[model samples]
Structures are given as structure tokens and as C-alpha cells.
Target: MLTGGPLDVLTGDYLAELTMLILGRDRLRNPDLGYAKTFLRQLEEGLGLAHERGVRIVANAGGLNPAGLADAVRALADKVGVPVRVAHVEGDDLMRLGAAEVPEVPEGPGEGLPAGASGEALAGAWAGALTANAYLGGAGITACLRAGADVVVTGRVTDAALVSGPAAWWFGWGPEEYDRLAGAVVAGHVLECGTQATGGNYAFFTAHDVRRPGFPLAEVWEDGSAVVTKHPGTGGVVSPGTVTAQLLYETQGARYLGPDVTARLDTVRLTPDGEDRVRISGTVGEPPPDTLKVGVTRVGGWRNEVVFVLTGLDVEAKAELVREQLADALAGAAGVSWTLARTDHADADTQETASALLRLVVRDPSPDRVGRELTGAAVELALASYPGFHVTAPPGPAQPYGVFTSALVPAASVPHTAVLPDGTRLRVGGGAGPGTAAPHDPRLPAGHGTASGADPLPGPGVEPAVPVAGGGGVGGSPAGPPRHDPTTRAPLGLLAGARSGDKGGDANIGVWVEGDAAWEWLRDTLTVEFLRRLLPETAPLAVTRHELPRLRALNFTVAGILGDGVASGHRFDPQAKALGEWLRARHVDIPTRLLPPTPEGNHP
Candidate 1:
């Protein structure tokens, strides 16, 4: 599929937060076994096409051993006879600096640790301090490309850096080109996760054939304006909805922070350029931050969990019974947490309705507490507890948890070095210059309009709409069918599509509509309080909502919901990956006209 051509660069992201911790652990045991071995398999199969078509390849497959990966690639190139010039980027690892040198080590539970977890609880989390790698920028990549390398492998570079580096190198963009860099950042971000920019994980899955979605490509120009597109006859559809979904994925606040420059996502404009092509423009870029982010992983403690199944009448009683039994079985433990989820419906339906689950979790620094004792306590009640006593599954053995700690290091402190195919090493200064660019104006080119003047916030204009009092629905000039009474209730997903994710301990949900009438209805209906009403779980939480009128979207940030992000969150859907879908499933009153027309000419 990659051989179809029509691309300047092909980038792959092979490392993630958890993947880094896992690889670092492996590296501590065997120095040469840290790199992603899958890269070798992929290179062996695809390097020939990449070399033949002259498509530059960049990837961050060098987890903790870029040097070893480079050596392996050299030997593989010889065997394959591809003459591939492979170069690797290094200098993001900070483990050698020791724990004392690290600053702002996240105290307690927040970004990486479990919420309300004590500092001593996570002392074991940092068990084998291997290599703490910082997220590097695109400078190293441009260096390798400039050094005449075809393949550039890196360790701990930001995912988007793969695209940003290639775009920066191809366009000859300097460090001070903030707006252009921001544009490239948007392009890189969209393409970093491959098919995400296409239609994978899209809200409107039925709208396109996503079974075999194609990889996306960014046709970037010197001006930093790029059209996000995929190859012809691809399975996925790329409209404003898909593009907006990808833009809102895993983002925090208005600023999309990166090592190269801070890209203001609010100023971005997504215009449809024919089919399967979205033009990304007007992304304001500011000067890069002085420091780069570093991720450190430590062994926290051992944790184990078991689920008690409650069925039929007195489900609550059944859950309480199990809790009492476990409390007596294992009295001495660091902590024991329990949550009962009522999966049962109101009506007496299938046997599945009797499937409410009561989950019990035990965590301690001592393996014995979380392992045999934790599982044994639950197992002891298998024949002695509640009516129709049964467990969802057998409680598994305890596992050591790793606490991911983050820090910021001076960009200059870490000297990024690029090793070429010929073993010639060159120093690559990280990040860009400190020149701040003006705000982006959608009406004009970024940094060219009123940005230098008093009005620096030149983003999209907020739309004016009257908020309806009861439920949601607006009183305005009807653009679609005549306004119908919003007295009837329907699923919110009928009119809107949403995408959500976690940021640290918080969760962000972006909900959007396609039509003007729907947009007006959503603006008035999907308020913060109303959303809380729909999802009672968020009722007690602090939620802030931001409106993006240009995209007809509403972004809600719910704090402390994920309980210190994905790694430690206790929620069934950790990281809030299904948060948007869950919100969409909530029923809300909607106007008949706002609802889609069925084949029988009735509102769906």
C-alpha cells in the first residue's frame, strides 16, 4: 500500500507512554534488547519500495537503544541489498542524570500516579531506573535528512515530530517561522496516528467504508498550508467531521503544546477541498517553550482486582454481602476500594439484565497483600456468599504498577545528536528560536494582520445564538424545516457526533453538529449543567465548557474524572476513550425537525 507513491515523506510512530516504560524495563535487563523489533520486520518488507520511490521514511522506533537499532538496520540493509541509508537520533534519555537532578517531580498522584495515592506508595514504582527519555523535537530529524539519510529512527521524539521534521526540512523552514511551524505541527499531529486522520475511530462510522481505511498524507507547502488527504479510492471518508474529531483527540486547553512551537488550535481553519481532502490553514504558532517534557517511570506497588456478579432481585444486597465477606477475609491491607456498577435495566428483560458488577481492588507495596491475600479473600466467598453467588471471573495475580512521572528539562541541556549511515555523528540543536509570532487571523495569513498590533487574539469569531430555556432548541430564523416542538426525547447522537479523551487526570469531550439548525440547537442544549444532568457521574465534578462556533463544536473539560490519567484510572473506560460515545448515548429532548427523516418521512 505504501508503494502507491504521491507522498514526500512517510512517518511511523512506534513508541507510546506505556511502551516506553516497558521498553525501558527491558533495556535495564539486556542493553541491546530495548528497540522495537517490529521495525526490522517492517523495514525488511517495505524498505525496497521506500528506497525505489525516493519517499523519505522517519519513525521513532528507537525506544531506549537507537544506537543498537541503527546497527541492526545496517546489517539488515546489507542482507536485503537495498542500500538504505539509515540514521538514528538520540539524547532524549535523562535516566543517567539520577533522581536528584530531576525537578518538579510530580508529588503524590496527578499526571502519572493514582489519585490520592501517597508518595511512599509509589516508591517502588520507580524500581529499575533505566532511561528517562524526554520528548525530542524535529531538529534531530532535519539534521539526519540534511545529512543525506533516507531513513531516520529516533528515541522518545514527540509523535508529531516525525511529520514536523520532514515538513521543516522539505520547506526549509527556519526556527523563527512560528506560523509555518504551527501549520506543520497541525499537519504532523493529524498524520501522527496514521488512519486516525482518515476515518478510524470516527464517530460517524456508518458514513464511510472504514473496514480498510487508508493511511493519510499531508501535502504541505512552503506557506505551511497543507491539504490532509489520503490516496485515491481509499475506503475512508475525510470531511470536516473526521478532521475535527482528529483535531480534538487527546488535546488540552486552547494551546497544543509541542517542543518546536505552541500551535494555537482555536485559530485553525478546516475547509473541505473536494472529497477526502481537508485544507488546514490559519494555525497561529508561538515561540517554543524553553524546556522539553521528560517522562520517568517507576514501580509503584502490586495491585489486584476481582469482580462480583449480582443478579436478579436485591442486587444491592448481593454486592454489600460480598464486600462484608472480603472485609473480614483480608483485614490488614494498605487499601481496599470497591465500586458497584448497576448494569441492569428497569424492565425484566434477558438474563443479561441481572449482570450488575461489584468490583473490588486491593493495592499495597507488599506483593503478599495484593497477591494471594487479595485473591484468596474473594475466592473464600465463592461458596459462602450471597444468593446465586458467582464471580464475573477469577481474580488474577497481582501485578507491579509503574508510576509515570513528568518533568521539564532545558532544551539546550540535552544535546541531540544524529548518527548517519556512515557513522558520522553531528550535533543538532533542539527546538526553535525565541521569536514569538503574531496571532493567526483566518481572514489573512498568520502573523501578517493585526497580530503585531494591540489585538493579538485573532482567532475565529464566536457565533451569536439565543439560548432556549427548557431543554435545548433555539428561537431564530429557521434554516432547515420549520421548528418543531422539542418536547420529545431522543438520543443526542442522532444530531451530534462527539470525540473525547483524557489529559492528565482530566477528560475532554468535543461535541459537534453538521447543520446550522443543529448547531444552534446544540449550542443552547449541551450546556455544562445539562451535560452533568445527562451523565450523573459528572454531576459532582468540576466541568468547564468552551464553544468553538467556527466548527459548531462544544468542548467540555471534566477535571479529576480519569483519576490521574489512563495508567492509574479505576474507571472501566480508563482515559475516557469511550466518554464521548457514552455522552452521545444519553437521551435528550430534541425538536422533530432537528431529528433525521426516516424512509417513512417521519423523524427518526
Candidate 2:
């Protein structure tokens, strides 16, 4: 909701990415006006909230223009008469980094997943770095607190680092205690991406007033564990269950990794303590592998999203005819490219003069060449089919298009920070690394696996594991109707967004599915009722119904707690993929059954 990019903001479908040549992996704060507006609004509100609560502050709301944004805030401080000394942590803004000085993408050969190897080369080194902000560690923030900054405005600091920095300043912690700092860092990570997971982009919210989902308020303890809450009377729920649900959003099996540590995220407990309150605790943390993390994307080549409003013709016959003509027109195309998918496909076979959209993807290293070849495709459509020119192919040749490449940058290359700007001196309380564990020598590194979203399996006899070893169920359920809807509400803008890559701290769940079939319609409308009934019946396992596109299929992840090994992430493994193959190979007795909807008639 606060940032750009569909995938970056909301969770849904992202079919594929065209390969991008990496120019460089540099991080910098965006100076875009829109981002700054979002930052300023949140920082002011978060500060107001903290001020009311008698909490001190230093912040990084400077998104794109650290100094410029800071200057405006400084004017505000002058009005409030709060003498705040600000520190601006700099040097990682890649827009300033030279290409010759461009660092190499980290990742030794064969260290990452099959798709994980698309290093920064795809970005085109000649272009160099645009932004290089990392989720910062605790070191720099400590300086800001000591310098006595009334408020800190920095560009591209880690979200969790904002909170953890204060903690370090409050307690004077050293890097040798990085694990404890990491623990607090993880806590901050959970809430950094904005609203509570329960309401923002999270699927479990009962009545999210997205219109006004208040920004989360985290209360960190000495152990590095924190409780996530939100402003009173705001839209959205704050409970252990909701937080736990969020924790499971992106994890692969039972693994949770930090730059210096990987937590075996067990001991997750959610319980209702009172109205709109839940406590989430994760005390057990693992050490991170000494390997750099990176993001990799590949361009499978070019594809034109040609949408057409088809009408007036033997729909199927005309479509086939058009496809043939276009294919023929692209006869010498490096790779023959053609598809005949029509909207309301059910009507494609019998309808005459129906509306439709056609998409064609051309694959080649030379985007210009591919774009050139498409010209004939347009003419064939107009000339080959009945009145085709009057409709889809009207008097023009398809134009050339540029395709983007894919690439990655190492974690070391991503800069993080804490700051004490020029005129403020405010002490940032709290300490870093109160609970971080040491690295295990045999650790597997981050970025070695695929992006999450695999379908889930059925688990057997599962329970919510808590990090504290024993559980005191810290959250509660609504005894009455929910007070607000997090989805429909406006942003309280309590906190500005944290640095780039800071989105990695929250806990996630990984579901598994085997293959792609009837994928566009998750589980073929198997229905949530079936999932609900199936869950209780499993007895010893947990059951979660999700639309998992990774498996390219609808999946039911059953955890042992829900009585099956599905959502629990136990029993499933790399070897189990063979089991998926076995299932695919066998005949399935699937029913074309209707699925039950929620009482409101919305499909779950």
C-alpha cells in the first residue's frame, strides 16, 4: 500500500520476469516525492505516538532524500522547540557508486538454487548501482543515540534496525552480542513492512479495516522478544494467532534465517490476552551461515500482452485461422511463437463474434529483432480471418519492444544505517542482540532456496511451537464483534518504512503442492468448507487451504497439529518431491464438486 511495484506491495500473481542485465547492485534512498510523502506522514505519527507514551526517539523517514527530508523535519522540531541533533548515516547510495568500483555479485558456483544464480550481471554493470540500502545492523544506530539526536532521519536503514538501534543505545551492547541484537532485529523485522500481518496483506484477518489499519506498535523486552500491537480503536486484529499466521507466511519448512543467524522457528504461540491484544515470542534463534544473500531473476525472453476485444465471427474457427496466419507470418522467426487463448474460453468453442484477447511471447536475446518480426503478425491477423482487420489487426504492424534482464546483489553490498542528524540529541533506548544465538558451522545459507509459495501437504498431530520452550498462550479471540476493519481504514502512518531488504524479518509458513494443473482456479474450487471439515478430521495435523502458484496447483498444507503433516512443514522434504511425481503419475479420483463459500458468499 505504501510502496510501488505490484509484487512489492501486494501478494498475488507475478507470472514471470524478463531477464535483466545487472548494471550493478548498489542501494540508495529514492528521492521520489511520493515515497517521501508517505515517509513524512508515518514518521510524524509514529513520533507523536511515542511522544505520548513518554518514549524517546530517533528515526529513518528520509526514504529518498535523507538530507532534504531531514531538513523539513528539522523545521518541525524548531517549531516544537525540541533541540534534536540528527545524524545521517551515508555511503551506500549506489547512484553515487562507480561501475569500475562495482562489487562482484556474491555466491560461489552451485551455492544457490537453480534460479538463485542470476547475479548482478543481468543489470548491466555499465549502468552501475541505483540503491544499496541493507537492513542495517546495530552499530551505527548506537552512535545516533549517544550523539543525542532528538530525531534521526536516514535513508535506507533496516526497519528492525530502527528499533534495535535504540535498544543498543539504551544498553551499550557490542557486536560480539550480535545474536541478541539479531533477536531484537527479528522482532523489528516482523512489524517493519507496515501494518500488523493480521490485517495488511495477511489472509487471516476477520475484519480488517484496510482503510485504517493502524501502524503496529512493538514493545520490546530485555530478552529481545516483543509484543506487536496497534493504536486503539483502529482497524485490524492484534493477536498471537494472527501474528503466528503471519510468521508462517514465507518460511520453508521450519527454517528462519537472519544475516548472521537462522532460527529454528518453533515455539510459536498465539492466545487472546484481552480485547485487541496478543503477544508473540520467539526466543530460540540459530546462527546464520557465513554466506552472502542475493536475489536472482531470469528473463525467459519477450512476450507481448496483446489484448483484443473479439467479436462477430465463428469464434473458435476464426481464432484458429488467425493463429495459423500469424504463425505463418512469423515463419522465419528464430522460435515460432503463437498462442490462441481467448477470454470466456468456455464461449470460445461455440460463440460467434465474441470478445477476446490474444497474447504472443517471442523468445530471443535480441529484443529488437523479436520486435521487428512481430510486424507481420499484425498484418496476417487483418488479412487472414473474417473481418479481422476491422477488429484486432487494424492497419498497422506490431512494433519492437525492449526486454529487461535478470540479476542479483550480495547482502554485503546492501548498506544499512543509524543516524544523528545535525541539530538534535535524543537518546534511542534499548539494546541490540539480547537473544541472538551463535552460527552453526554446518549452516545452510540464505538465498540458496527458491522464493516461497509452494503448495502444502497434510501433516499429522501438529501444535503451535513457541520459542520460549513452554507456552502461556499470550493472545485472545474476539468476545464481541471486531471494532475496526484494517482493510478499509486509512494509514495512521505511525512509522515510516524501514530500509530496503528489511522485509525479511517476519516468520512465514511454506505450503507444498506437486504440479501445475487447473492452477488458475486453485484446487478447482474445492472450497473452504472442505478444508475446515478436513482440518478437524485430521485430528493430529494442521490443515491450511491456500492458492499456491509455485506448485502451479491448488494445495492443502496439512500440519501435524491440524492432525496431518500438511501445514505443519514436517514430513515434507526435497525427497518428497518424488512423492509428488508418484501422485502425478497415478490416476486421481477427483470430483468436479462445487465448493461452499463463506456466509457472506465470498470464496475463502
Candidate 3:
């Protein structure tokens, strides 16, 4: 869930380990650093809090740079006057996987610029390596836990381990409790990565002083269920708006097939007990298919890149000439991925079209010929440059870098561990039992208010319910309008799900329940007591949806469950699963479906 980044590095307190893997093309902000460190800080803080609370912590914050990061945590331990143990998950950086080790990786077609492209390479080497990172798992973390280290730092462990490790720490739950582990995994997915649930990206549509939204805080009970909440006073809100946003991001819209398991997002209830508290609860799910999709990157081949600017000549013609030149130089060599793009403005700067700027990107993972072929780009660019000295030029290749993709590895190929660093792992004298390092100063950083912990804060006014959505045992269709008033229905909304829809395609649904009765309670059963008892502590999704008239049918033009990404391969979040299971057991069937995809359209 977290990769190295500023916000993440702070979580080193409690995290026992981390999975810092990066794929070919991803938009994760901290793929190189930010989020990675956040998870690390989680372990550090968690362990620090746990140590104070008398618990152990283990984590893998090591992303692109493990040694440097490990050294950083070691420093924090020194500052806190505690010993920190860092176990490095060695040997998985895919940057080393090259053409020899990975045969399938393509030998790039090193194409150059048409006329003008980019600046020069600071340095020159051989091949070009695509994105690469290791997929270290829980084993090394187990070593850290056993090593008597209060904290553990790792590189590229799976994202779920953030929460899953804690499940292992507290419950001694094995892989058999995969579902439970999955619950914690989802918990991490919601909290650890997003930084603060409601305050983070999810708050985009709503207006709240993000001046400094409350940093997320997770309340982990002995039972192993964690509720995600932020210090209340901080300007941002954690309503259904944000939590649902996190649920859909980068998820490829598949709710069932999540990262670790084909999870099940069941019973989900979001009850705003007071001003800021929203409770999220639920279940994880079934094992994924036998083979996990593995991406391997070795030194594939070499790549030569060049930039060029075209002027006077037609843009298309210049691009064609560059392509033909590179093709001849490649001499029938297998072409890898290569891209030629317009770097600068295509239109004339001030007046009529005089010139255009462009960039050419080429890559081939072929080791032997791949390296030799890489120069093709620079050569072609050099050739083009002779004709128009006006055309700009870019740099050459770097060390031979190539990544190979791997697939279908047996589950056993990777190891699993829910290891905790050796320590008291809990609080000294206490009420809820403190976590590592004297509970991490429990210091509610500035704007964020602490959880009055002394006594329950006085309850606020009636619940501020949003819209309502009904989807339960009723075979994917929405149930008829409930037996409650539209105005106060939300007030009585025991359980409901809602998400706004933008202009046509951009429309979205953040909530999707497993059973109808669950959806019913969400939409029709809001009361003080219901808010208190029924609501969960984490995944506190506050928004609710009620189907409007014309949109009542609830499916896209094509039939499917939730057109919103929730029902896709992504699993039902813990809150939904937990709430859903309870309803399914009750066997209450609301009489409608949500997005039942017709037999022909494969939407769902």
C-alpha cells in the first residue's frame, strides 16, 4: 500500500515490514519514495507505540533504497533510545534482470529524433531498463521479529502486510485465517496508504479546510479489528466521499479480485456517531488463483534515446523519415517497445507554423544485439541532424537495463509471515494496552484533536445522512423504495450506500452491499442507538446513496452490478463484508437487483 515518500516514512513506528514493489507503468505518487516511507513510519510509530504499549513492530519501508532507509530507522531508534533491527530482503531488485536471464524481454528499437528532441544524457551506458522493483514477502520480516529488534525495515514486501502483519502479531492467525488477514489487509489499504482516509484524495469533491487535514489514526482492538479515524479537529472530513475514493483508485474496477485475495466486501456501515467518528467494519476473502502474476526485470537489452525538433518540413514526414532510418539500422532485429512523441509545442509560438518539437523514446530488452542496436536511435538522430542543424538533439543510453515479466508462480514460491519485533508488544500498566514505544507520544500533532479517551464525547445532533442505495439478496437489482420518508429516510438510514454520478460516464457508485437487508438497514434504520452500535470504527464511509427516479434501475446502459468501480474485481471492503455477512445470515431479501448485467453484456 505504501511506497517511499515523505508522509509514509513517518509510519516507521509500528510497521513490522513492507512490500515495496513497483511495476512498469503506475501512477502511484511515491513509487520511488513517498508512500514507501509512510508505511515504514507506520511500523516505527506502531512499534514505538507498541513498545510503550508493550508490543513489537516489523515493517519494510525500503523501496528503491533499502540501505539508506534502514539507516534512517536505526537513527530514529537511537533518538528514541531504543534498539531498532532492520532486516533487508535481499536479492530482488529487477533492474538486474537482463536479456540473458529474461529471454522474452524485447530488444528495443532504438529510434532517434526526427530533427530536434531533447537535451543530452548526463552520462551514457548500454541498454535501458524498464521499471523494476522486488516483491519481497513476509519471511525476512519473521527474521526481524525473531532478531530481538524492536523495529524491522524491509524493501518491497506485499502491501497487505502492513495490516496483515499486525493480525499475525496479535492473533497468531496463520495463513489459514487468510480471510481475517485479508480484513486487516483491506484495513491497511484504506488507512496506511491513503495517509488519512477522509482527509486525503477522497475529499476532492467536498469542501473542507485541508489546511492540515487530520493525519489518519487506526484504533486496533485486541480482537484484531482496526477502525480508521483521524484526530477530529483537523479540518478535513472522512465521510463516505473519501473512503470510497480510495476504494476505486488504481483498482481496475474489480472488487472481487483484489491485490492479495479475491476479497469479499461485505456488510458495510458508516454511522457518524458524532461530528467526526465514522465506523468501518467487514471481512476479507478467498485465496487468489494458484498463480500470482509476477513481473520480473533483469538486464534485458539496451536502448538508445534521442530527441529532435522538426521545422519547415511536415511533422508527419519528418517522423516517417526518422522511423525509416532507425528501421534500417535495426536490420530486422526484434523490435522492443519504442515511442516517438512530440515534446515541444506543435503549433507556432506566436505566428504561423514555422517549426515543431518532438521526443523519441526507444527500448529493447535484447541483451546481445539489443545493446549494439541501441545506437540506432542516436545514429538516426545524427543522420537527421545533418540535414537541419536547426533540429535539437538529446542524450544517449544508460547502462544496459531491461526487465523481464514473470507469471503464474506457485503461491508457495513466496513466503508468508506475520512476524513482530521482539518486545513487550503492549502497554505497561494499562487500559487499552499501549503499543510500541510508549504509544508514540500519542501526541495528536497540532490541528488534530485527540480522542478524549477519558470519556465518550457528548453525542452530536441526529445523524447527517446522505443518499441511500439498496442492493442486497435481491439478485443485483435495487429494491423498491424503502418504507421510510425521503426526507427523514436518511435520518433513519440504518444502512444505505450512495455515490454521486457525474456527466454520464464519470458517474460513480461508492457503495455496494452483499445483501438487500443490509442495504435496507443502511437506508432506513438511522437512530441514535443504531448509529452507536451498528457503526464501525474504520472504513467509516459516511456518504449514502438513494436511487433517483429515472436512474432507479441502477445499472449502466449495459447491465452489471455497480457501474462504480466498487463491484468490479475489487473486493467489498471490511465494513461491507462484516455488515453483509450479518445480513446474509439474517436471510432477509430485499426484492431488487442493482446492476445485474444482461446475459450478453459482460460488464459485471
Q: Against the true structure, whose TM-score is highest?
A: 1
Residue-level lDDT for 533 in candidate 1: 83
> lDDT tens digits, residues 3-64, model 2?
21111111111011111112111112223331244545554544444444434554555544
Quote the lDDT for 201 in model 3: 38
User: lDDT value for candidate 2?
Assistant: 0.40
lDDT of 1 by residue, 55-154 (tens): 8889899888888888888898889898888899988776644444433323222234453343243333344644567888898898899888899889
RMSD of each: 6.4, 14.2, 18.2
Task: Provide the lDDT at 412 for model 2.
Answer: 46
Model 3 root mean square deviation, Cα atoms: 18.2
Error of 3 at 219 (Å): 3.1
lDDT of 1: 0.73
Error of 1 at 493 (Å): 1.6
Order by TM-score, highest first: 1, 2, 3
Which candidate should be chosen as best, given lDDT against the real structure? 1
TM-score of each: 0.85, 0.54, 0.47
Summed backbone clashes in each candidate are 7, 154, 173
**Model 2: which ten-residue window has the lowest total lDDT?**
493-502
Off by over 4 Å in 2: 1-84, 93-135, 154-159, 170-183, 204-212, 251-253, 291-304, 310-319, 328-356, 361-419, 422-604
